[model samples]
Structures are given as structure tokens and as C-alpha cells.
Target: MHPLRSATAAPSRRALACALSLALFPFVAAATDGMSDARTLDRVVVIGTPTQPLTFVTDTKLPRQPVPASDGADYLKTIPGFTALRNGGTNGDPVLRGMFGSRLNLLSNDGSMPGACPARMDNPLSYVAPETYDTLVVVKGPQTVLWGPGASAGTVRFQRETPRFDAPGLRVQGSLLGGSFVRNDQLLDATAGNATGYARLTANRSESGDYRDGHGDRVPTAWKKWNTDLALGWTPDADTLVEVSAGIGDGQARYAGRGMDGAQFKRESLGLRFEKAFHGALRKVQASLYRNDADHVMDNYTLRDPNPMGPMPMPMASNVDRTTDGGRIAAEWGWGDVVLTTGIDAQRSRHRTRNAMGRDAYKTVAWSPDATLRNTGVFAEGTWTLDAGRRWVAGLRSDRARATDQRATRSAMGMGGMAMPNPTLGLTRSETLPAGFVRFEHDIAGSGFGWYAGVGHTARMPDYWELISPNMGPMGTVNAFAGVRPEKTTQLDIGGQYRGKRMDAWVSAYAGRIDDFILFRYPTGGMMGATSMASNVDARIHGAEAGVDLRLAADWSVGGSLAWAWGANTTAGTPLPQMTPLEGRLTAGWDNGHWSAGALLRVVARQDRVAVGQGNVVGRDLGPSAGFATLALNAGYRLSERLQLAAGMDNLFDRAYAEHLNLAGSADFGYPAMPVRINEPGRNLWLKLNFTL
Candidate 1:
């Protein structure tokens, strides 16, 4: 009973081509009428540039090659040392240097949007649309403490810059995309403003049908998503601003790796912010508050029929939701060459769920609260310029985290056919976590090279998923929260960046040790079907990433990057699970002011070191994954001052490949009984048009 066997027919090639033409007709017409005026236009091209070590910043409005991403995780894969654990075409969990979950602090406009699903059916990045933001910033390693807690791996921020206007004006930007597998996308951003006030709006929609692999086998990856945001700002005077914003989004996705599919991904968000400048030692003040809610529904009968002989055996559904509220206030002071920033922040979140035996019956069941989490932190960061060629940066923070468990009884399925007592019933636990980092940077005399080294330490409390999702606890413990200790990480990071007239390069490396690193143990063929246990162990990790770009001629350039990561469980003497393999990317491009063309050649080394059935919250390693290489081509044309067109072909050779950190296809999808890695999309062609005024 394969799902796709009863799925609807795919779009015909002729129909797809017609749709693409119709979508591009407006841009083509504008190009014909304004080609002579194109000199005033800004070039819109698709290849992303290499990032520097430690910190990288870029404009999110720029289009990316291999087709623009539908979500944040998909877009982050362009950066070195980053990968995603894919379940389908969208909502893949982001991983950095073999770390997942709270280790990588992700923020959208300085707000947190943690998902509610214990199994992570909707990760934080699931609600983020990268292109909707104005800027994207990445800080590697535990280099700073101003943002939030954890972040042992790194920090990612998607921000929208405030708009300023001297007089009444209107600005608009939008794009349309058409691609293989009946993929279609639309985005719009509009703003109207004067010196005293402004109104802004952003909206986007994306949809795609199931795609076949190179072997012509269909993968259950269809999805549809939409988002809309509105904001109002008041500028009382220069250096003063107050703004309020609201947003809503929803989507549905089919997964090939799980028994259930996400039928609803509803989201709502609200935020308020204020900024003001001052004289004397106090340079400025900033504060903000936000609330985000995620409501999700999963069922086996929504998108496909339940396997008659499978574990489920019948239609069923589950609904889960989480609401988070938090705020932060900070003050920035400047004294000569030294700047100091201090802030306090706090957040509270609650989770609830309902389940029913019949399809869509969950709606009739009353919701039951399962967990509540709270955290409050205070921090200060400072930067000092010792001289023209040297600088020092440091920060420290402490957080109090608390979790309350509300389960009345434990599942009896895995307790030897006997009811098990709930050891954590109405129990609450709290921990105090401290974190800090210090770094020094120096510039090479007479050269464009700068080098930096830093040391950081972080103590992290176990998150909801890690504390309550497992079926069993470690040896001698009744449950995870009752025994799991806080995780501590200490690491050293070193990197250098070089900026030259014709070439630019950067490299970053880190080595660290972890205390009480959370680990999951799964028993094979257990009575409850592979029950899991959560425990802690010591571990060591190291990784490095490097990239370079060279200008061969006035209109030609070439670039490439390489990344490698490794980890070991010192207590058990085994290689860590789900580590990304050696990866390299080579890109060549030519730009002639108005037109550009590029090619990307990606090579991944085989990943033979794996600990099967052991990994982070998102997914586990299936087995060893073979190496693969893929070639992609892209071309762009700047037609006029208000229009541009871009086209690309991914996996030009139609090579069948799967990422090492990937979800295993499900038996319900016609996959083998044994877990096997799901293949990536095959040859794909896409065209995009951009318009601005």
C-alpha cells in the first residue's frame, strides 16, 4: 500500500512549460520596453558569495542559485560547515558541526519561536521564511553572549532593518518563481512612509508537488505554505522609533520518514519594540517584547491511508500546541574606544496536546497540558579598541531555567505489560547556568589579513524534547528530567580572514570538550518497538572550515570551500553520530554588468563512520552513506530598472544521492522494511523574476 500509488497524477511537461511562460510574461514585456534604461537598475543575480570566518553578514533580498529556498534551513545549506536533517522538501532541522537543537540558537527579529511537537515535526526554522527578512547574520562558535543562552554551536539571526524616510514615499519589491515538480512561489514586500510614520507589509506563498528521484521513484515530499506580516512604526524624531508588528502563517507537509504527516502548521506572532539615543556615556537604549504560538496537527489519514499491517493499523490523529512569551531590554554605553552593553531577558512557554483514535477526532478531545518551561537571564558584553590594529571583546551571563512535568501516568506499552508509575508527576526542577567568552583580534601590519582566537564556556539545561520525549530513562533513573544533569561545554576557537584586491579567503577551526553530553540509547526489537533511553556521557569535538574566492579577470571569478567535522564519545570510545562528512564546493561565474552566468560543482566524501540508531532529536544515522557529486548551472539577466530574470538547473546529470544526516524512508512509502536513507530530488529546472519600484 504505497502512498504515491493512489496519489494524483503529476503535471504534464507541456502544462508546466506554459505556466512558466505565463509567469514570466510580465517581466519579459517590461524588459523589452526599458532595456535602454537598464543602466539605472541594480543587478539581480543568483549565486551566493563565500562567507568569512567567525562572523558573516549578507542581504537576504538577494536571490540564490539552485532556486531560492522555501525555508531558512534550506537556505543555510549554502554556508560551509552547515547541513540539514531532511524529512521532506521543507522544514528540515538545521545542524552545525554535528550539533542540533538549542545548541544552535535561532532568532527571527530577536524573537524565539520554539516548536511544540515532542518529535520535532515543526522545528523553529519551520516558521521562518528567509527572503522575507532584510538581513541574515551568522556568528560561529560560542563567541558572544548578548543574544541568549546555550548557543554552544553558534547563533543565527534573521533581521528586518528599519526604514527611514525624509519625505512621503512608497517602495515595493516582489518576485515570482516557477520550477519542476509543479513548484510555484510568490513574494511581496511593500512599505509606505514619511518622516513621522510608516507602514510595512510582507507576504509570501509557496507550493510544490511530490518529486521523483533519479530512479523515477516518487518521494512523498509535497508541501504548501503561506505567510503574511504587517508592521507600523512611529518616528517621533531623529534617533527615536517605536514599532509594533503582527504576523500569521500556516502550512502542510508530507513526510516519507514518519508514520504521520503534518496536516496543519498554524502560527501567530506579535511584537513591540522601541529604540532611543542619548548623549554622554549612555549611547543608546533598546527594548522589545514578543509572543509566538504554534499549533500543529498530525495524522495518518489526511494525506495517505494507514498501512493495514503497520504499527498504527488504523486512522488516528494528534494535535499539539505551544505558546512562548518573552522580552529583553538593553542599554549601550560608549566611553572613548570602549563600548559596553548590558541587558536582561526572560521567556516562558507551555505545551499541551490531544489525541484521538479516529481521523480528525483529536478536535473533540480536551487538551491536556504536559509541560511548562521558564528561563530568565542577565548579561553584559564589552568591546575595547586597544589600538588601530588590535581589539578585545568579552561577555558573561547567567540564567535560571525551570521545568515542570505534568504527566499523570506513564505509558504501559513498554513496562512488561504492566502499568508504570509516573515518577515525575507534578514535579518541577530548576538549574542555574553560567556562560561567557573572551576573544582578541589583531590585524597584520601592511596586510589585509586579520586573525582572532577565543575561548568560551557554556552550561545548558536540557530542553523539553530531551527531557520528556523518550520512552525510558537512564540506568537507575525513573525518567530523563529526574536524572539528566546540565550539559557543560568548554572550547577554543581560532580563525583568520584575508581581504585582497583580487582574492579573498577565510578559515575557522574549533576544538571542545563536553561534560554530561546527552546521549540516546535504543534497544533493538524491544517489546515496544525500539524503545529509547536518555543518558549523559563525556565527549570531544573538533572541526574546521575554509573558503576562498579569486578574480581571474575583469568579468570572471572562481571560488570554493571545504568543511570537516569530527566527534568522539570519550566515555564509550565510539565516534559521535550524525557528523557531517568532508564536503567541498567549487563555483565559477562571469558577469558583464547586465548579464551573468555561473556553475557550481559540489563534492561530498563518503561517510563510513556512523553509530546507527543514535543521533540528536531530529533524526538518527541509518548507515554509511556513499559520496556524491552534483553540478548546477545558473544564468541571470538584468532587464531594466524594475525587472530581472534568473534561471537555474540543479543536479544537471540527474545523479541519485542522499545526505549523510538524513531521515530513513518509511515502509508506507514503498521503501524496504529496513530503514534506508531517502534520496534527494533529481534534475530540477527553475525560473524566477524580480520586480522593484
Candidate 2:
């Protein structure tokens, strides 16, 4: 086996491991066979909903179950075809089919929460806590237009549902967890309602210490966070409902790849929504508006313990803060067998910065506007039922966006001999983009088999942060992304699903071509040091994913999922960098009346083809990475109707491994000495206690 793909067990021990895994199969089978056929077919377990084939739903209205969700992006990786650009123990930036940032629309309660850091320290999801919301929904690829525009990769929404009651009622659910490496978490959700109105509150706190890798080596990535939200609703009748909601969140983290750490993240959000159901021609009408604000603070001081041997040596500091204010109004109306949806959206964002070398020195530098940007757009989509078993959907959208970069002068440093305060001058850009899509679906077997095909197009404008961020390396240069052109993409997707009493399965495939794809490149010839720049290049990508669940007996279940992806830049006739390798996951579990146990095995194939340079819009590409496989085991027990417990160990075999999309550790972590690409945790132990009342 290649060094990276070596089997965790030696040839001599392989037999022992196999025997152990098979020994428990009989017990699981016996328990599963005890369940009634009716109950088995009626149960529904989902992480997403049916807006699209790739979409999954998480309903917070039900008691929350334990899933290993350390961060917003980490939580998303549970979906097939989804991966993360691992930064540290957490905050791994989410990527879908090799796309990141605005390419994927992320929202909370229908509000925009864009980040400010040039390096994206305050990633849009970093401030979000999944346990604090009522729902988590994700639509993969440009498969739907219910959210917003420029969502070629997909859309993610964290929402809170309104409560209704004909009489008075109250509900409360909470969880507490303590585990290895000083990990601890607390979450609470409560709601109350009367015949005329309702209210809800949610809060959560999480923290963990530096963790040891598979080889028992320490990795200095740790953090803590907290957030809370409140909602009030008015429901005078069964057909009409209105709600007002607000939320706040803040946190700090230690990063192993960047110079500065996340010291403070402050967020505020407000929203209003109205929904009504008509008795006659129209079935329902729904509309909502939301506003979000994010203020971030980053520096070398206070956040993390200072290191004399680190890059700064001295306590240098700089802070960039931004405010994003936006709202969307949409309505969905149904007539007979057809549905029509339309919406408009607008947002304004501004940034300001301050810098100083000494600890408190920067406090005196007057903060001034660094960048300003705005966007306005409108969209419409219609779904028509052509026949009893067939339907068609079509959509169109247009957006006008403007960006202004204001700076006295570029740093004395130059990128690739291109001096600052460029002879070409600062940049101002205004772009108009149009997008559209069409899809067809049909029910093959009325009993629960269906297939669908779709074609989508999107014209995306470069975001403001990417346009003026620093190069972030020894180079001291800046990445002038302002001159970059808008990117356009055309894609075709096809998928099918089958549901039955003993088995359930789904499969999907996609092929796409992109024009002027924005590619980030690192230049060895930096005017000062090493600098990375963003540019446009042509590219094409294709991938497929399939999953199946089988009930071996009434009490036993087995399932597996597989995904494969490939991409190349036609401009250079080379493989695309950071493309996820072919991977597969197998799971086996058993559930009796009061207890459940399961185990998982994940396999990854090596990637030898690479472009040698191109990477994500904000990260660097490490060419052709090796791959491996790992195993995990988990079990849960119900103590009573309102109480439960769960425990699990990931990397059960304690195998040493690293991912293909991993970032290098920093000086504080003894980086190069421990440069095995930051191996995953050897063996992790966690236990959760859940209560519902």
C-alpha cells in the first residue's frame, strides 16, 4: 500500500478485525427482526427535505438527536458529495463540487451573513450554531431557485419555525455533553403558545481543547462560542400568521494556519414573515423579510497565547470589520396543479480597517471605509404539472451589483513586479448578470420510484472581499481581484430515487462547463516575497453519487454511499486542483426497543492527476494528495420517554491519516516538525445526554 493508504491493520491482524466486526451481526439481526413491518415502512429519518433530490431536511421541532456537528460547515459534510477544506480542528470551509463562498448561498432565517476578513476568518457559517435553529436545509447544486441568485453550487438555509396553538401549551428540550480533550456543550430550546400568539427562545454554548492526532501528537486548534435567538408570533386565525424574530452570536478561536486569530465575532439579525392560505383558487401565499449584521475583530493579541518564535515575534495588530444589511421578499402562489413563485432582494455592505504594530498602537488609527458594495435583484420561477405523472419547472433571474475600492495607496510591496497604487489606478466595477434554469420530473412507479433531469445557467459577479484582500504570505503583496470578470456556468443534472419496504436507494450525476472560472494562483516571482493572485480560467467538471439503505431484518439495517468527481482546466489541459477523490461509506446498525448500536467504514481513493497550481478562490493547492480509509463506531440508549444517551468513537482503529484538502499547521503548533498534514484524531470519545419536556 502507498504510505498514505496503508491499511490500519497488518495482514496478520486483518482476520481478527474481520471476525470481531462479524461477531456482533447476529445480535443486531435478531433485534431488528422484532420490529413490525408497518412501523418500519412508516418511519422517516432525514437530514434534509424534498425541494430537490439532493436536498435533506433537519426538523428542530422534533427532539434533537446527537450528530457529530462541531461547526456549521462540519455539519454539512454529512451530506454526500460534500467536503471541507480542513483549516484546523474546526472551521473547515465547506465546498460542493469544488465551489466555495458566494458560489453557495448560505442564509439564517432568510438573512444574509457575509464575512469581512480578507482571508475569511469569520466565515459565514463560523458564527452559526445548528443546535440553536429549528431547521437546517440544504439543496445541492443549482437545482432550485427558491433562495437567491448566483447559487451555482447550492443553497443552505437555517430556519426557525413559528409555533401555533388552539389552546395553551409549552415545550422545552435541552442537551449537555462532556467528552475527551476538555470538550463540553450545552443547548436549550423552549417555546410557549396560546390560541392567539406564540413565543420561542434558543441558546447554545460549545468549547473544546487542543486534540491529539492519530499518532498521539498534539494539534493546537481549539475554540468556544455562544448564541441565542428569540421569536414572537401572531396567529389570529388558521389561515394567517406573522412573526418577528431576532438573534445574536459571538465567539473566538485559535487557528493553526494563519497569522492572526479570531478574537471577537459579533452578530445581530432581525426578521419578519407573513403567511396565509386561501380557500379558493390560490392555495397559499408566503412572504418574509430579514436583516443581518456581522461585526468581526481579529488581531495577534488576546485571542491566542503569543509565541515568540511565531511569525509576528512582536504583538502586531490589525482589524477589519464590516456590516452586511440585506432583506428578501418572496411569495409562493398555487393554482390548480401549477405553482408560481417570485421574489426581489437587495443588500448593501461596507468595510473599514485599522492597523498598528504595537499592542495598543492601532487604537489611534482612525477607522475609515475600506470598501463599499451593493446588490439588487429579482427572480421568478414556475412549476407546471403537464400530466398526472409528469411535471416541469422553469426559472429566470437578473441582478445588478456595484463595488468600489477606496485606498490611499497600495503597500510599497509589489506582486510579480506589478507596483502598488497600480499605474492602472484603483478599481470600480458594475455588473449586470442574467441566470435561468429548466427541469423535468416524472413518477416511474407510482408506489415510490421517480426520476428527474435539469439544466441550469448562472452568471455570477465577483464578491467584494475577494476583490481587495491581501496576498497573505511572506510576499506582503495584495491580490487585485477587482479587474476579474464575472463567471458564467452551464450545467446538466440527472437523478432518480426508489423507495420500498426493505430497501431505499438514490443516484445522481452532473456535468458542467464554466467560462472565465475564477482561479486563485500563487506566484513564485513575488515583487517582495511569495504572493497569490486570483484570475479567470476556463474549466469543466463531472461527477456522480449514489446511496442505498437496506433492511436485513426487522431490527437490523445496512447502508452505503459512494461519490466520485473529476475536473480539468481546458485552458491548461490539466486536472483541476483540490478535486475530491472517489470515496465510499458503509454503515451497519441495530436498534432494539431501548438500545441502538452502529459502526461505519469510510474508504478514499488516491488522486494522482492534478493541475499543479489552481485552487479555491482563497486557498492554495497542494498537488496530488494520497488517500486512506478509516472506521467509526457508535451506540445510543433511551432511558425513558424524555431522556436519552449516545456515545461514539471515531477513527476506532486509531489510524494515522490526513485529508487531501488540508492546510499546514502554524508555528505555535510546532508546524514543520509535526507536518504530516495534521493527522485526524486517533480515537475520539463523546457522550451526549438529551432531555425533552
TM-score for each candidate, following the candidate numbering:
0.95, 0.88
Note each model's CA RMSD in angstroms: 2.8, 7.7
lDDT of each: 0.84, 0.70
Worst 10 residues of 1 by lDDT: 37-46
- Candidate 1 residue spans exceeding 4 A from truth: 1-10, 13-23, 26-53, 412-419, 524-530
Give the Cα error of residue 89 in candidate 1, in Å.
Answer: 0.9
Candidate with the greatest lDDT versus the true structure: 1
lDDT of 2 by residue, 555-605 (tens): 899888888888888988877777888888888878885787777788888
Which structure among the candidates has the greatest TM-score? 1
Residue 206 C-alpha lDDT in model 2: 79
